[model samples]
Target: MRILLHICCAPCSLTVVRTLQDMGHEVTGLYYNPNIHPVGEYLRRRDTLRQFQEQMGIKVLYKDNEYDPQIYFKEIAFREANRCFHCYRIRLERTLFIAKRGRFDAYTTSLLYSKFQKHDVIADLGRDLAGGGQVGFFYHDFREGWKEGIEQSKAMGMYRQDYCGCLYSDFERRKKLLSE
Candidate 1:
């Protein structure tokens, strides 16, 4: 099957990409994270993904020239308590649309590879968004390979980010650090 993988960052994509390829699926990637705060951090992830694509020989479509965090904030406005839902929704919604537009057999996200991510939430959202089966939602529990992904990414010298990318997450991370 031709699958479009939503890549949040290069580190997360390591295991996700290998698993898809090993299963003999033709994989293409999409980097559409507007949730990443501070343009510098966003660029670092994007550049690392570019390097990964070249090394892994996967075709990845970048909407980097179209990065806009304000749109992201607006999408999650007044829904701070439910920010994760909105964050995952926006990125996955775009991936779903792009998959339909590109005529892909299915779509999945590397977000599933993050140990910190809400896996069940993302899976449920993906399934719900796959409505009418216009394009399939391929759900894989990529967290199983979390250790391997981290090891491989570090071995490959990828930039590993600490936070989940949203401003709220960043604040929470700093708050935890201050408490420590």
Candidate 2:
């Protein structure tokens, strides 16, 4: 099956990509992260992904758009608790739309590989986006390979982000790191 893998970042996608390929699925990396804050950070992640794609010999669908923090902030709007729900909705929705248009058999995301992310929430959003379409959502607990993913990323010299993406999460990461 051909899979449209929504790549959050090169580091997170490292193991996921390899795993998918090992399963004999053709993988195309999609970079559609409007959630990654600050223009510089977004570009950094993009560039890293480009490098990884080249090294892995994978096809890429790059959504070269500027970082729009407002889209995220406005959607979540004071509901700090449910911010991730909206974020997942926006991203997975985009992926599903592309999958429908592109006629891909299935779709998945590197976000699922992150131990820090809300796994169940992401799965819920993915299911909602699919809406019983021909395109199915592939959910794997890639968090099981978290340590190996990080290690492989380090060896590959990928840029590993500290925060989980959104501005609030970035600020929270900074605050937590500072206190520690």
Candidate 3:
């Protein structure tokens, strides 16, 4: 199966890419995260994913690297309490649209790999976006490879970020650290 994998970052994509290839699926990465806050952090993650793609000889499609935090904030501002749900919808909708245009058999995301993310919500969103079987949602519990992915990323000298993207997540991370 040809699959378009939505990559959030290099560390998260490492195992997902490997696993898909091992399972005999052709995977092309799509890097489109407008939700990552601050231009520096966004560039770092995008560059890291590019580095990994080069090293692995994987094909990837990158959206324009325009720093537009306003677009993200605008989408989630009113829905701050359910920001992630809006965030997931924005990204997944785009992924599915791309998958349909690219003629990919299915689409999945590295978001599912993070224990910090709401997996059920993402899965449901993917399913909803993939309605009518125009493209399938390739659901996999990638968190099972979480530890190994971390080790592999470290071995590769990849940049592993501490927070889920976005200013809100960064603030939450700092808050948790202070509390601890």
Tens-place lDDT digits, model 2, residues 1-180: 999999889999988988888889999988888888887898899999887787876898988763477777777888878888888887788888898899999999999998888899898888778878899998888888899999999998888888878787789878966898
* Cα lDDT listed for each candidate: 0.92, 0.86, 0.89
Better of 1 and 2 by TM-score: 1
Candidate 3 lDDT, 55-142, residue by residue in tens = 7657999985544777788889878999999888888888898999999999999999988899999999898889878699999999
User: For candidate 2, what is the total of clashing residue pairs?
Assistant: 0
TM-score of each: 0.95, 0.93, 0.93
Which candidate achieves the best lDDT against the true structure? 1
Worst 10 residues of 3 by lDDT: 63-72
lDDT, ranked from best to worst: 1, 3, 2
Per-residue error for 22 in candidate 1, Å, reads 0.4
Clashing residue pairs, backbone N/CA/C < 3 A, model 1: none
